[model samples]
Each structure stands twice: as structure tokens, then as C-alpha cells.
Target: MVTTGHWIDSSWKLQKRVLSFVHIPPPRRGVEISDAIFKCLKEWGIENKIFTISVDNASNNDVAIRLLKDTFSMSKNLVCAGKLFHVRCCAHILNLMVQDGLSQIVDITDNIRESIEFVNRSDGRLLLFADIFKKVFPRFRDREPHYDCCPSEEDWVKVVKVCNILETFWATTQIISGSDYPTSNLFLQEIKRVKLVLDNGVNDEDDFIRAMVRKMKTKFDKHWGECNLLMAVAAILDPRQKMKAVEFYFPQLFPSNEAQENISKVTTVLFEFYDEYVAANDHDH
Candidate 1:
């Protein structure tokens, strides 16, 4: 299924509507995907109004966008080329990173999942587990336990620490995935928080947490080491933040020397985009 949306009003909320939901059998090729998207746009009579396309972090998506760019080139639209036309789904990238981190504690997760399944399979099992829980903790005999199985104190401590670390990622993901608000400009700030969480976790006393965070950091760096230009431009254009946000965050995002060079490059690009917009508007007028 393919869907399309646009930012609505000054508040920048996504107003999404379904475009196509045809069942296309795999193995799906880049050309086929591009053709479907192009066909949909043409049908909607908005082929020339193409802007950024957000897609999951799949290798075939890269190819699909390249094909889409070629298709767009046939039109007179000048801005439908290069990085300006491609915006990767940040939520997908975050999911990949979190999954990588979670893999380190798969055994614990599997055990928990299995225990839940066991208890949920039958009412008898649940009653038995609850009875055992009351016997195990006499102080809590007056109250019913929410869960059937109780984890060991050590296991419980580890779970709490893990949840605390993951809570940051979970919250950030929710913010970025908001369809009711602008996410592009907010990406840099949220991602910086994610990096901070990972950095802090790396120094944790618990070896398990540090190891998990180290793995996640590797994946995070692989996907988002350098900030994307679309995100930078969006942040720059926001009246509340403007360029100060970039100036404040880029130093931490890059090495001391590279930070200055990146800022200069980003500023140059921003101006170039501004010039293009001005020239286009003048021509339209």
C-alpha cells in the first residue's frame, strides 16, 4: 500500500490520505516501485509538485528513489532531483538501532515473552501463578499481582535499568513519528538526545547495559553520523530555532575541527537553496 500526505498550515501537521492500495506481488524491483509512485502522482495530477519522499531504510528504496528521480526528470520541475527529493524515515532507522541493542539481551526478552505466553494460554495457569505469587510474598497477600510471573530481584533490577534507558528512545520515537506536528525540524534535537542517552549508557557500571549501548551506538553512527541537509534546512528555517540550533548542536555532532567546516558547508547550501527559491518565485511572478 502507498500513502501520501502534506504539511498543513503554519502548525505543520501531516494531513495524510491514502493514494493507492493495490496488491503488488514480490519480488519487487526498484523500477516497479518507482513506476507505481509515478503513476499515482500522475493520476492525482500532482506529478510536477513532487517534494521529498519519505521511505524506510531499505537498499531497494535507494534504487527506487533513483528511478523516481529519472522519472521526475521528464517533467519541467527543476527541484525534484538529488537529496532534496529523498527523506529517509527516521522512525525506521531508530527501530533498527533499538533492535540491534535489544539483540544483546535476547535471552532475557525471550524468557519474559515465554513466561507471559505461558500465563496467558490458560486461566488455570494464571490462577496457579497468582496463588504462587501470594505465597511467595506474604506482605503483598492483600493485593493481587498484575503479572503472573515474578522476576528475581537481580533480574528485576536489570529490567528496570534497561527500561529506563529504552524509555528515552521510546519517547523520542513518539515525538518524531507524530503526524499531528512537524518532525523534520525536531529531528536534530530528538536525535541529539538519543545520542546523549547512548553516550551516558556506555559509561554505566553494569557491563550488560554498556555492552548493549555500545552496539546501539555503532548502529546509530552508521545511520545518522552526519546530519542530513533536509533536517538542517528545516531547523534553520524554524523561526523559534533558526540557525542557533544548528550552531549549538553541530559541534557536539562532529569533531571540533570538522564541526566548523560542516557549519560553513551547511550555511552555503542553505543560501543556495534560498537563492533558488527566490529565482523560482520571481520567475513565477
Candidate 2:
């Protein structure tokens, strides 16, 4: 079963240690859900020995935080109140990157939603796309043909975003160019931009990577327009050097844009350790 949250409690009785598990059920009733889990723990005779509560960056999970606070209010003597609640999940931030990134690109967002709809409505179409995709990139060998992102899955959004991006660049060069399709120089420019991002050829060596990093940082420092969530995500996804570009700018670079409102909302629920975890995990290769 897919699990999002789990809690463990321990107690010391002189030389003996006792432990118990608290499984936080799937979110059904908003933030109050955490309270239910805590109540269950109390009933099980698990005292206030919660070292940490790890959660994803979901708003409802934030409700869990509020619920914890409320529970503390009820039994101040029983709970420490300031127990560590770590809200750090790397996959979650990656998921958020897709949401924030693609939302800025209307074409990317529209195409992905449409593609998912097209695939879900017809099994044959899904098979066809998978077949064609495999032929295009045989390394993606899989028995059953399936779209990267199914509308039924939350992480499906990331799959769709990645596929749309990769496909758009590939199609632009091999299919669109020198074809009957009406193409513009502007389209070619966008394709080039995408290619530069995909290839990450700007940073070949230590010096080159440093130079590119400086240039990007300079651009970010000078420009005050917006955070360009898509651009930020492209940098985050850059496989070269473990997204050093992102490490250079953490909480400061992230929440600077209006597009980051949702991200901010989520981050606010996280403790300090959780934020650092987010920074470190995204920096991981």
C-alpha cells in the first residue's frame, strides 16, 4: 500500500525501551487527520515521545500540523508541543516543480492535459503512443504501451511534463523541420532554447560550469520580473552537476515569484530541518 505518513514513539523504562507505530491514514478530512492519528496513539498508551513527524508538502498535511498544535493545547503537560515535524520529501518538491513549471507554459500545460485525455479515453491510442515513443527512444523498452503520466496518478503530471518537453524538442527538429508543417523562426528559437536546456552543454568542464553558474546567478540577481518557475525547474532537472544551479539559490530563489505562492504555502508548513532536507535532496544527483 502507498503510504504518505508514519509515526513512531519510544519510551525508556530505566534500562528498557518500548516502541510503537502510528500509521497516519490517507488524508480524508483535511488537517484534522493528524489529530486522529495522535488520538489513536494516545489510546494505544503511546506517551509524548514523538521524535519526528515527516510529512509531504501538501496543504492538508499542513492541517496535520495545525491539528498537532491543537492537540498540544488540549494536553500541554503530555506533549512537548515543539516536537520535530519534518515536512521534507524530495519527490514532492519535484512534483511541485512540474506543477509550477508547466503552469507558466500554456502550450506545454495544454498539450499534456490533452495528451492524457487522449490516452485515457482509448486504450488503443495509449498503446500507439507508447509504441511510437519506444521506437523513437528504444531504451524506453516496456512490454505494455502506456503514457508516462496517467490522469489517475498524482505524479502523472511530472511524467506528462517530461514527455511533452522531450517530444516537443524531438519533433521540432526531426519532424517539423523541412516538412509541410507551418513553422516559424520563433518556434525554432524556442526549440533551440529547449535543446540547450535538455543537453546542458553549457557546462562541460569545471570552468565552464562555474562560468555558467555565475551567469545564471547574475541574471537572477539583476532581473526582477518573475522567478520563471519553468526555467527554475529546467535548472533543477539539469542532470549535469546535480543541479548546482539550484543549490546556489535556495529558499531565496524559490519563493521570489508569484508562481511560487503554492510552494510558499507548502513550505510554510515545513520545519527548518525539512527545508534544509528539501535543499539537500534536490541537490542530490
- Candidate achieving the largest lDDT: 1
TM-score of each: 0.88, 0.33
Record all residue pairs in model 2 with backbone atoms less than 3 Å apart, i.e. clashing: 31-63
In terms of TM-score, the best-performing candidate is: 1
lDDT of 2 by residue, 1-285 (tens): 122223322542212122334455555555556656566657656435443444566677677766775665566422223433333333343334334434444454565576557555877766766667633222222333543532333334444544554454445445323323322222323433443443352343434333433443333233322333333343334455233443444333334554356344323433343554575479555
Clashes of each: 0, 1
Residues 208-243, candidate 1, lDDT per residue (tens digit)?
A: 899999999998888887768888888989999998
Cα distance off (Å), candidate 2, residue 33: 0.8
TM accuracy, model 2: 0.33
Candidate 2, residue 281: lDDT = 72
Off by over 4 Å in 2: 1-31, 73-83, 86-88, 103-285
